[model samples]
Target chain A: MSKDKLTIGTLLFPDYDLLDVNGTLRMLGALENVNILMISQSGDKIKSNCQVGNYIDYNFDNCPELDVLFVPGGIGTRKEVNNPILLEFIKSQIPKVKYVLVVCTGGGLVAKTGLLDGKRATSNKIAWEWVTSQGSNVCWIKKARWVVDGKFYTSAGVSAGMDMALGFISDVYGREVADNIALRTEYDWHDNPDWDPFSDKILEKK
Target chain B: MSKDKLTIGTLLFPDYDLLDVNGTLRMLGALENVNILMISQSGDKIKSNCQVGNYIDYNFDNCPELDVLFVPGGIGTRKEVNNPILLEFIKSQIPKVKYVLVVCTGGGLVAKTGLLDGKRATSNKIAWEWVTSQGSNVCWIKKARWVVDGKFYTSAGVSAGMDMALGFISDVYGREVADNIALRTEYDWHDNPDWDPFSDKILEKK
Candidate 1:
């Protein structure tokens, strides 16, 4: 095993979409020595929007410095947008981490962090208007499957996080590692970042 | 309410890849009144090969007849292929369920049920040879993201299951419902059933 150890923290909250968390985890965790810390505010068993539960590895107070911060979203992101404690916890870590990857409406949370104020980002298209409105200054890409502005990677929605994770892995490790993951997972990844066709359908209707 | 209640039993064995279960659940659970049962051999919390834990909703002995049977896979699939109890449990349910969906190496387990004996199917490309060999009479598609043979839908691997779920939802609910899911999840779904580029790359190497 390579002596490269990168600590990855996947933040969890109430009723987050398990697809984003699990699919992204499947990709990132495939990397060697990539420690995944399931961080939550209370360190409780995080209940997913899909009715599944996940045991939190650390509470906000005990969360260590991470190499990468991963945030997933669901119905909770709508309510958690105004949560000062979660916002503060996230804000404190933004400057210290190597990067940040936001999934679905997790972009809403990241938007609250002010990290995307001047950065290009994206979020779950179904809740596009509400999430994009959170940060007025951020340039929200209306037609992106995922966005990578500097070290920040933001995915469109739940399953899109899987694509973002594959891209993220490719960025961190290289094409071979990421391709190996897609091959192992038997996923034909639409690696093109500008692959979101939902924006036209969902946003146009709304 | 549409009075549409479909019980989706997601089979969880020891060391199953959590992605297959999580991705498919995100899509199916989005529907109204769709119950997801995380079934296992013993109804114990399954420990995934990736070191994650998922609690089971039902054990094999107590599992009810289902509308849909969902199966995921991992290293455990290789061992479970010979498991008579597990095979019998699957064998018994073949006639009772409305349809069956097998993801990744879970196809290996399904092949042991002899239900796919004359059906076209696929599995994780990395272990395609071994999994396909389980059902000698079965027509194993060399390049398919997923295959539909009667009441059975078998996906090539991990993330391909998500694509299959989208297609399955489209087939059951209607184009609009599945479209809504893809839009809401912001997933740029591989809707084409024949999109399996990795099989050429991965299988060719072997």
Candidate 2:
């Protein structure tokens, strides 16, 4: 990769989970040459589902070309997944981007864009069935911490977004860099690649 | 309390943890009748610590008379705790407010104002000493999830703010109302009355 820099863009929408977006951004911000952008469908600031005065910045049209695109899940994803403009944009951008990351039901949005067709994916437990319903060709991985089929990476709910982002960093730079980022952020990165939230262990513990 | 309505104000600083503030707001928003305002030092949009674009709405001078003032912790709190203007504003407003809720090291700011003198308090593990060093005659309960010394309520890290907010709601309203809010938000309320984050159980688990 050129020292010119790489941009990571995360889609933000009304009622989106602010932490998922932030956790990812914080991790990526630690990368020396990465530029992170918070983009929304209308490019206008949208209220986060967090309701505590959190918003996402930038609009889709104004966002710079991205090397990575991340979509995080929240109540907003229900409407966002079906937003034609957003879906079309993702479809147009996916092939050009080096990686596409989706967390929680964000996978649903990517699924709706037909990008995950014939690929393995995962999402929040509440939205797993809905994710499956979106595409018959996509193999919905029932027990996966994150599914990486080709350039697409997907993780389970909220906190899982942090894991996937770190994983992406690990892939691009190396595991050592990702570990340092996780340590600095005080997050415990689960090294088990096959960990899944829907497992009987997690459900039973909950 | 008459249904005169209580206005709750939360401060936003650059690099503030969006989740800590938003989680508390989400709980408060579910309440029957309350006004919530997001205030910043300058009233300009304050980016969160994550730099993902979450911001609170109002500025300090424009803040309305508040029934309660909530301060949430993040990397931003490190600077805000000692900000002269912010400390002055908080000192001026503390006498008028009915209650003050400080989450994580947000208590450091309150402590700076001498409000927590001869009181007990707790904050996130990372800042417990910093909180104590600020001249509060504080009984630092290491294992406590939250410490409520009279009208002052202080909690541990990020998610613990949600718990302390619910506790505040219970005090202002009733246990039933708090319980209902917790259920609605899918948060489990432990009725321990005190929260200590540094206990062996929490540390041992990690």
Q: Give the TM-score of candidate 2.
A: 0.79
Q: Write the per-residue lDDT of candidate 2 for residues A96-136, one digit (tens) a residue.
A: 99889888778888888777888988777655667667777
Instruction: Put down candidate 1 lDDT per residue, B1-206, tens digits, no spaces.
Output: 23568888988888888788888888888887788888888986667766666656789888886988888888889889989998988888888888899999999999988888989988888888889888999999989998999999999888888889988988888878888787777676789989888888889878
In Å, residue B5's CA in model 2 sits off its true spot by 7.3
Each candidate structure's TM-score, on Cα atoms with residue i matched to residue i, is: 0.91, 0.79
Could you give candidate 1's fraction of true interface contacts? 0.70
* Candidates, DockQ: 0.62, 0.25
- Which residue pairs in model 2 clash with each other? A43-A59, B15-B49, B143-B196, B144-B195, B144-B196, B145-B195, B145-B196, B146-B195
Worst 10 residues of 2 chain B by lDDT: B195-204
Poorly placed runs, candidate 1 (over 4 Å): A1-3, A204-206, B1-3, B204-206
lDDT of 1 by residue, A1-206 (tens): 23578898988999888888888898887787688888989987767888776657799988888988999888999888989999988898888998898998999999987878999999988888889889999999999989999989999888888899999988878889898888788776879989877888878877
Fraction of the true interface contacts (Cα pairs closer than 8 Å across chains) found in each model: 0.70, 0.21
Q: Where in model 2 is the C-alpha error above 4 Å?
A: A1-6, A30-33, A52-57, A166-206, B1-7, B22-35, B95-99, B143-145, B158-206
Q: Record all residue pairs in model 1 with backbone atoms less than 3 Å apart, i.e. clashing.
A: none
